[model samples]
Target: MKQGQHKQTDPDPAAHVSAGSLQGYKGLTPALLTKLAKLGISNMQGLLLHMPLRYVDETRITAVRDLRSGEQAQVQGEVVHVEVQYRPRKVLICRLNDQSGQLVLRFLHFYPSQLASLKEGKQIRALGEVRSGFFGWEMVHPQYRVVGDETEVATALTPVYPTTAGLSQAVIRKWIAWALSHADLSDTLPASVSQSLNLPSFAQSLACLHHPAPEADLASLESREHPAWQRLAFEELLAQQLSMRRHYARRKHQGAPALKPSKTLITALLKSLPFALTQAQQKVALEIGRDLEKPYPMQRLLQGDVGSGKTIVAAMAAMQAIEQGWQAAIMAPTEILAEQHYQKMQGWLAPLGIQVAWLAGSQGKKQRREMLAAIADGQAQLVIGTHALFQEQVVFQRLALAIVDEQHRFGVQQRLSLRQKGGQPHQLMMSATPIPRTLSMSYFADLDVSVIDELPPGRTPIVTRLISDARRDEVLERVQDACMQGRQAYWVCPLIEESEALQLQTVTDTYETLQQSFPHLKVGLVHGRMKPAEKQTVMAAFSAGETQLLVATTVIEVGVDVPNASLMVIEHAERMGLSQLHQLRGRVGRGAAKSSCILLYQDGKLSEMARARLKTIYESTDGFVIAQADLAQRGPGEFMGIRQSGVPMLKIADLERDHELLEAARELAERWLETEPVLVDKHLARWLGHAEELVKV
Candidate 1:
């Protein structure tokens, strides 16, 4: 029979079984299945599809005498003795003896039920690492099987895979065996496409991967040009590219009504600022002003490093809407940040006689109701707050533009929800994390990018220092010295409390320690779990100088601007992602005061990736440079935990390695979708459908 058309002995798929299925297999319970499902594996096909990461070559058996001290080998011998060692650590020791020599199989922490199966005077085959013990040769924690009709199978090379907590390797193997026996293989990719791609038949690849006839087959799988991996990666990337292309094309062609700026009002507001706008700020602000005048609503991303004067650019955009007799809003990720922006805008824009309102969850019900009424009546020209802006109660007279702060913090759905408020609003997604141009093209291709690469003049570069935990006292003393001069300080901790799994400083614990050490200094604490109002109060205390030091979590990483704050101490700094560290460091260097950031890390051990990040931060103050290095060190997936950022996750395509392929796929999709528009061809529709599914992953 042809491989792809294999027929099952039983016509009923459910009635079929395999050689490995036991009438009552031990430990095959419903709980284990549920756990496996949580790991993204479900059903018989999933069991077989989860291929082994690697395979061990046990085809050649070695005698005990032939085993070297550091080699991994399979040895066969007759069981001479079996003993249970119950002293220091529970272990089951089995000794095997052949004509050549003696070998002991030690199983540490073995279950009592397993002892009955391993008996004395039984011939068995064992696979493990060979090591020298006091009694000579030994195999530690090895797999073994008693002499049986299928003993020859034990001598063959075995596949090893990554499994979850509750699933055992043996159980996974048995389930895969059942799938291989019962599953009716069907070819998904057409023969013409396979031939054009120089790919193997789907059935042959799957079967060869599961049960390779020879070691050469395994070697072929590892090659970069392997048909299975190449095809899978390409398909996954193409799907995502197609979705992005479609979205881009749709947005670019959509007609948007643009509003003209009110020069009188903008001039009045700019005159009230305590400081003059920088040249970089003026340029970006003017660019935004022009975009607002077009027939199409602006959908732009403002990319800038930390402290690169992006806040002013956002203000300029908001001013344009206000001048055109429309409302504008800025959405921050957190309440504290939202409140901070509200206070700043009130101080700057309120002087121009422009009405501004702050809407957040932490506000009193009466206050929120009043703000909503004001917005609906067109009394509020500018509004700033958290996600609460999208709630149905808050209506705008003319919501022309929406500015999202730290854009990555919210997902595409959340951002869309904001635009969907009233009619579609022009979006300006702003991010302080400077991503390289190449990576940004793949990740944010849906928006037009405007980068403010140059920093505002007179902004001092922060002095960075890497200090081991052993020098904690010196760092604390320096912080005290800085605070003595009326400079505010931020002590950032990795966690809120000590964890058994992690050895890092917690915010609450650090706050308590710092309070005790500096009794005279006022200290305020903030974290994610705190109520929004409470967080705002503490942040206000810090800003008002009621608190000289603020011990907080990374919640303050974005949108909390205190120009007078010049000192930053990050505990367990090496544990943070590069982008996170940069944001934390950015909390300082805002004011004219010479600022400094102390990265306090635990002494001794550090992973290579962590070391690279710490070194990069110390060597450069440029966020773009740091971002590029971070991307190279850790792929985009690991860089920011993209899932939490509301961004779609890529499965097989590496943003760093497959960037060129991603671009090509995007180009092809854009050209095809633009030219054909509807994907009328059946094959083309099928490809487009597959690509559409990838955009959401």
Candidate 2:
């Protein structure tokens, strides 16, 4: 072998046996066990499933002259000088030379043993990115070891595992090698299913991924686009689908009130509205109406664009349940939104002999007690509130329908707790934030989906404008013009209290500035810090056209529908997310007047991500297109909040890249579940060990 080449061996023959526990190995200590436990590696299978974050190519050695700046390479050379300096900072510098060139190695932090090993005149191998330093080519904090006569280089790429502070890469590699030799690496999927999908065997894929040969496609391995990676990703996605399906089946076994569709309240409510329901709304209302008639629990997600009229659909669903003598509850993520629902529903239902009760965290003890009593006595035919609806003290006599608005903003546990208030109550989740197709296939595979794809008639499309903060004076003039024209406007800011670190405009400051600039017009302010009554008062004035210009934070993002608010000017729009910007823009365009949204971004301060978000929002107003772009940019983890919730995040799958695999897995899981019960059980056991948390939500 010239260099960086060695003999290879076939994968161990223990592949037919299943993986065993970590305790089966000898020479285990308490300290090592604690570390392994912390990493969640209690068995040999856990070690194999712990994939590498990235791979380092240490399979080749380049000559010193061939080292390129900004490229990583390993070089063998003799150290000619070694010194420790203490000037601007304590440092150790070594000069190494080969026949082609001299290389400098600098370490800001070093060990005494490393100094002894890297003495002058010692031949060593160093691997790191080469960069241009003051002293020609250099590498900082490179991995270096003394060269010995019997030393052999690696013929395969090296893996950098996700490790804890105490667990070293060497220890993990040693344990994995042992497991590869002793544990069974059999395929979990059946032969027919695996062959139908054209996926590789589990044992072969694992071996190839862990020890990829030098000739293996380096780019594919690093980006996880290789077939070996795809095979594992498919298995992981299949596991997730199976888990969700199983929970969905369990829900199907439970009994619900079976509130048949009643037209008594539905007809009255529809006739009372000033406008008729859109075709899309009527269609989704029928879908929800039928779901309410099923004995099994209904878990449906009603999604639509902003101002698409989801609240009315939810109200229709609640009316059906109430007409069938079952109470309904609606929960919102914020006090502002919850109060909005309470007021609107009370207006529509109170005259129809329906008692709509209100509950919120900010309510006084006496008010809360009265609300709770009404709910317990079943006197509150329709209950609307914030997260207080799920609080333990607020008991519901008969809550058959549970509606959650802006559902994605809530954690899984909060939603689950509300459902537990009534035995197997039908759930109707509404969101203005559209879920992309890939996410609908993966994260929300279990639920039935109904999309109100059309906006009600007379609602004008919003004309989005991206303007630099340097032109903010023009935007202010536009806001003043719109307000003077007998229409309302919203000026949204990112922060409420002063944040010097961010140094962006705050709501109070903007409110004061607008008041000073336009003395004749009313410039009211509302933020999360305001008391609920104060916010309600300010918002009521704005909704009634008393406040011409409202300076607020994102608290007005969802469910604050003002038909006359025809203009929205968001300050520091670069600091907001795409969904948030879209929602804020939705605050306008609810009325027939031609609406516009001005995004005031600091041009010089815009990052590439902020620029992309603003460009996407400015170019298109379609929620689905914007949702796709947002998903592609932020990914499903941050986009759907899989990392912070009760759902189990995928171990080896990227929803963006492995969407095809997700589709395949979903189909296969459904088919296998219908026919191959034993095989499904075996595969789920292999993938989801003690994953009770996935369904607890």
Clashes of each: 1, 1
TM-score of each: 0.81, 0.93
Question: Residue-wise lDDT of candidate 2 within 607-641, one digit each (tens)?
Answer: 99999999999999999899888888888888856
lDDT (CA) for every model shown?
A: 0.75, 0.86
Which numbered prediction scores highest in TM-score against the true structure?
A: 2
- How accurate locally is residue 361 in candidate 1, as Cα lDDT from 0 to 100? 86
lDDT of 1: 0.75
Q: What is the lDDT of candidate 2?
A: 0.86
- TM-score of structure candidate 1: 0.81
Off by over 4 Å in 2: 1-43, 65-70, 86-90, 97-102, 121-123, 131-137
Model 1 C-alpha RMSD to native:
6.1
